[model samples]
Target: MTISCPTCKKPSAPRAENKAFPFCSERCRLIDLGDWLSESYRVPVGPDATERDGVSEDEAAGRVRTPDDLPN
Candidate 1:
């Protein structure tokens, strides 16, 4: 099967010896890696504003109000 490189748009032959399977060459592979490291690619967390550790914004906001809320 023949595959085209996403970066260079070059046609590449499919073979077990091809280290850069999808990419045509090492340069294209490295470019893709650089994009990942530079934050060009983003994986969405979610719509909620809460922290990943389960700390909600409202809970954090409530911690600072009123002397009665403080522990002895």
Candidate 2:
């Protein structure tokens, strides 16, 4: 059985033998990771998630989103 590489559209068979699995090579896998890192791909989320993400993003960037977040 054979499968197609998600990155390059190449045939990749024998999943157990291919360390890259869904991708054809380490290069393809890294390329896919880069795409995700660059925001080339986005995952769908709900309104609740988006709201939570805003707070999390601010905190991750060492920001204080609200007055209550200020250090005492």
Candidate 3:
């Protein structure tokens, strides 16, 4: 049987013993994983939506300004 790597699209021999199935090598698998971990691939989200910790978007956007806002 034959299998092609999903990343490089290289032809690889299908081996039941091989741990890296669907990928030809560890490098290709790691590269694919790095793309995900480093956000080279992204899931689309709607605009005007942001992640906030407890604070409403308006409140977060309109935070108080003070002289302390300036770095010493």
lDDT of 1 by residue, 1-72 (tens): 679987678986575766886888777777777677886553333585335445565677867778787796
How well is each residue in 5-56 modelled by candidate 2, as lDDT tens digits? Answer: 8878899756688899878877777777777788745333345446677778
Stretch of 10 with least lDDT, candidate 1: 41-50
User: Looking at model 2, how many pairs of residues clash?
Assistant: 0
Off by over 4 Å in 1: 39-72
**Runs off by more than 4 Å, candidate 2:** 40-72
Q: What is the C-alpha lDDT of each candidate?
A: 0.69, 0.73, 0.68
Clashes of 1: 0
Using TM-score as the measure, the top candidate is 2
Candidate 3 per-residue lDDT, tens place, 27-71, comes to 777767767787655332456334543357678678868788898
RMSD of 3: 10.7
Give every collision pair in model 1.
Answer: none
Please report the TM-score between candidate 3 and the true structure.
0.45
lDDT of 2: 0.73
lDDT of 3: 0.68
